[model samples]
Target: MSTAGQEEPDLRSIYHASGPWTGQTLYVAAHLGLADLLDDDPRGIGDIAKATASDEDALYRFCRALTALGMLAEHPGRSFTLRQAGRALRRDAADGFRDGVLLQSGAVFRAWADVLHTVRTGRPAFDHALGMDYFEFLAANPEEARVFNRAMGATMPAAIAALEHYAFGTCATVVDVGGGDGRLLASVLSRHPGMHGVLQDLPGTVSQAGENLSGVADRCTLVGESFFDAVATGGDVYILSRVLHDWDDDNAGRILRRVREAMPAHGRLILVESVLRPADGDLRSVLGDLLMLVVLGGRERTESEWAELLESAGFTMRQVWDDPGLATTRGHSVIEAVARAEADRPDTAHSSPPKAA
Candidate 1:
């Protein structure tokens, strides 16, 4: 049944071999500031190497590889310019993914190399490779933590779109549990001028968040603590954006319970996360799920799974706003829930959930 002159698919080339090289190449480009250097105009390899203080011969080969990868456009006399894909590596581009590229190809790349270990042991490869959990590792490594925070901020716009999908009119005080760098909290306060915000995160993150939330600093209260202990009370709305997906169900439930305990009877819980699709074709969510698995032993959940998780933590799923047009590119959706009746609260005295590792 084979057609004459048609070649069979090379599964190994397509699936197995190309990813490492592509990821590493992108890391090199981002790490060297090559895209930012060429952002204004084309430059010769020698000029770029000089600007970056890199080996000219090695950088020349790197530029040639980028040209072949369609990220750079090669020209006469060995000058090179950025392609559309390469332009996204610029730090100043509004839609730039430079930080994300650095993160994924740097620490995340190292974690993925041990994916086989994760698959075999049901443990995070990052924990095994680094001798500490993801958050712990970030806490200890200041530079990598900066890269991680910036990477998180790089996708904040996509996650911010969820704010438009829900109504914050009834909310006067919003609490963002585990809100990193206060980007989400700042965005929320900017939109709802009358509303105030409480941003809770680890101490190190709270320090950085102070700068990020400076625009709305007067209206925001920063809490330097973990959500597993307690959150600021008296908030009309509590937000957990892209937080739950970083922990297992048990720890996630504990976080939700803490929020519930802090919330008033009528307060609402808003979860902004990537809800898994019924089918498997959503590239962002599928990849995000794997990233969580390999790095944190967490997961993206289905609608039913979310509902069940919420119910376990003394909340009832009120509505799920899945606006594909909003943040679909980043695979995010908004789910709104309410605290259940006092009698329905989990019996915390009888059971203890382990803190996130």
Candidate 2:
């Protein structure tokens, strides 16, 4: 009855010890495609092994591990079905994150192995592991590239919802800085008929936006150039959706500065990112932050962190919005920052709003 006072102790140590076991077991199931196989039918361990082409004994061990982890139910019949927590891996579902999760567990896992090196060197694990940066690695590995890009783009629905809910009452021409494949930009452009768009990104990335932006082509102009080298000018709203997180603060600042240069004093920058929060019933945000650490050498930033970044780039945060209920594996937070126009400021001669289309 007095166990609490006996050691006052090992709870923290126990939890910390269990962290790797939880993640590794999930990775094991993902790697073996066990859940995907079971999605079709409840299978015996032998059958699962046959279908996945895995060794039977190893498969049994894997299944036993999953069953112990509460990801599967094992009965006297020696057959297995997914537990409620594991059924999300089924491949046929419209929003199934199987591919994304598999891609991470398989490919990104290697990059993550170099996390210690990254910490020591202050460089991306991806760069150190592959001998090239992420975008460069993507350029060379077409298949893996698509998987990675899809995983990135898949977060758009929640992001789009947050954007639509935020007040964009005054924006007309909106420029999507580093908008890959134009999905997020297209969503915003579609929502506001009065708004035209400039989808600015790398030439290769912009080329892929053609098919994606077809429906919104009439209102979107695609501009291909390094955001560092050139950014298209003139827009009331400039967006950097999921862009700032890919680089360190210095480069992120450079991008914001470029957008600030192109934008008038009153222009607004809509920063769409997964805002990192402390563990407050939002585990997705925490997981995503760790993902950034292992995969990109980037960290998921807090609102205050974002504010500091924005301020350094000559912009100020005016509003921040989130739709956690709708977020994917990565929670969505839409931060709206404004580049104050002379008219809106205290010191300069007030100027009229930019011309609308």
Candidate 3:
């Protein structure tokens, strides 16, 4: 009984304290626009409660908890002040995490709720929870699609990180496979004045991409099509950023081989993806790895696994540029690769490709 420091922390207590309860409280506050409401001036609980139509006593207690969490500051006469952390939740904050939070609470929440299904069957739970493919669901729901796009745009640090970490080596044309909203490609084109880019994704995504690429539109070609079916051809380099980890290896192989087929003899591949450590990986990488499993039935791979995948797809990995500062970005490295000579590819690699996208 006296082994206080040796006693393990109570898992259930930790779960109640930090898991669903805390997460949902913050989500509800964000959904209710509490941050924006408090942005102009601190307000009494009565006024805030009236604005949100929440019970006065209940809202006061909620704000109190938020104050304790450092998202708000409790003030005299039951008033509350928004804290710096709370300011980030404002709808218009450029670097806000609001969209990602809302997404995690909405469709992602629904899908992750069935993660047991994913773990048991070794398949994504998203399809079962949403009654369709994840991308298809996004296509049908415009509002949600916008949120997903914005949420993903936050991860475009990978684009900047890629450019700094790897040299394009005087490439002429760059094709972005599964590029979302064209933000990443736009960044690339802006960096290389002479380079042209091809942005390919679902038809809906391509439409959104056009507007985002206005600055570089003259140098960018927006193509709307599924990467699994075909990729646009005749580029010096192909970029697969935040794409591969969305599906199982078989489907990923299909995408890679499609790129291989489209690739010219001297083409290069730039994979902006996380390179996981076989053991002792960081929490962000591993949590994202789990997110892939629950939502897409994909996986984050170690460097060796990445090399193996590339080799099997008729390409060979050249170098993996690990950027320590990019730990928080979409992917930690830009994996450079080149098309393997057809004669050098494994005989088994040319067999029937994956039917799934």
Expressed as tens digits, the lDDT of each residue in 1-357 for candidate 3 is: 334577667989867777866777788787778998995466999999899989999888888888877899988899998999988778888778877878777788888788899989988899889898787888899888888888888768756555553467668999999998888888888879999999999887788777779899999888899999999998988999888988788999999999999998878888888888636537678888998988888999889999999999998887776655544444557787888784354431221211221
Better of 1 and 2 by lDDT: 1
Error of 3 at 307 (Å): 1.3
Question: Can you rank all candidates by TM-score, best first?
Answer: 1, 3, 2
lDDT of 1 by residue, 186-249 (tens): 8889888899999999887788887778889999898999888888898988999999999889
Over 4 Å off, model 3: 1-17, 326-331, 342-357
Among all candidates shown, the one with the greatest TM-score: 1
> Candidates' TM-scores?
0.88, 0.81, 0.87
Once fitted onto the true fold, the runs of candidate 2 whose alpha carbons sit more than 4 angstroms away are 1-21, 75-77, 277-287, 323-330, 340-357
User: For every candidate structure, what is the RMSD over all alpha carbons to the true structure, in angstroms?
Assistant: 6.7, 5.4, 6.4
lDDT of 2 by residue, 1-357 (tens): 234446554777867646655566677776676777774356787787788888888778778888887788886656788877787665554555656776776667778778888778877787788788777777888887877777666666656665665556677788999888898888887778888999999887899998888878999999999999878998887888888887788888898899889987767778878787775545666767667766776777889999999889887777676655553424667787777444246643222321222
- Model 1 residue runs over 4 Å out of place are 1-13, 16-18, 278-280, 327-329, 342-357
Pitting candidate 1 against candidate 3, the one with the higher lDDT is 1
- CA lDDT of each prediction against the hidden true structure: 0.83, 0.75, 0.82
lDDT, model 3 = 0.82
Clash-forming residue pairs, model 3: none
